[model samples]
Target: MINRPETRDLLAEARQVLLDSLVPELGGERKYEALMIANAMGMAIREQEQQEAGEPESTDVMLSRFLAGHALPEESEQGEQTLARALRERVVDGSDRELRAVLRAMTETRLKVNNPGYLK
Candidate 1:
């Protein structure tokens, strides 16, 4: 049997404590730094919970797939630049509905990691 204080719950609790206690005392740039730390802790908690729940295909892998589609770019800086240019053009033209859906999902995933509240 598992003991009390699961890893994800512990992280969430610590993040809440920081937000509730120390974050209020901080000011100026320090407050921004505290908030960043709290945000990172929240992401960590989410990651732990997702892993424990048997989520397959990590966020990174899925994000890459969503960004690049099935065909991964040629593995080099020049190729990356080419891919970026192509994606930018497609974004402006708005021709590829599949690409748009992939982008939306990818953006949602990124927003979830960066600021879950935005989704709500």
Candidate 2:
């Protein structure tokens, strides 16, 4: 296990510095770019916090379910790339209700991590 002042803490501190110090001094495009960078850092912090809290990423859970339901071989052999291809095929076919539900759940999960504001 890692020590204190973890990844999330570091990112949060960096984001705070960007917002508190750099952003005030910046102007126009530079300020906009800095804000965008800070926003991305905030997202990374959230993702790191979720992982630290033992929450699994939606894609991993969804892919595992897909592999099990289909009786596919171990993930080590088929890998995410193959599973992602299968998922893409299902999405393109647009016929499986289960796949649609899984996709929706994944989308909501991602939104919660990357842009929770959109959920409100």
TM-score winner among the candidates? 2
lDDT of 1 by residue, 7-105 (tens): 788888899999999999999999999999998998887766655754424544544554466464546644335446666666433556655654565
State candidate 1's TM-score.
Answer: 0.60
lDDT of 2 by residue, 31-61 (tens): 9999999999988887777777655555667
Q: How accurate is candidate 2 locally (lDDT)?
A: 0.75
TM-score of each model, in listed order:
0.60, 0.71
Clashes (candidate 2): 0
In Å, residue 39's CA in model 1 sits off its true spot by: 1.7
Q: In model 1, where is the ten-residue run with the lowest total lDDT?
A: 54-63
TM-score of model 2 vs. true structure:
0.71
Pairs of residues at least 3 apart in sequence or in different chains that clash in candidate 2: none
Give the winner by lDDT: 2
Off by over 4 Å in 1: 1-4, 49-94
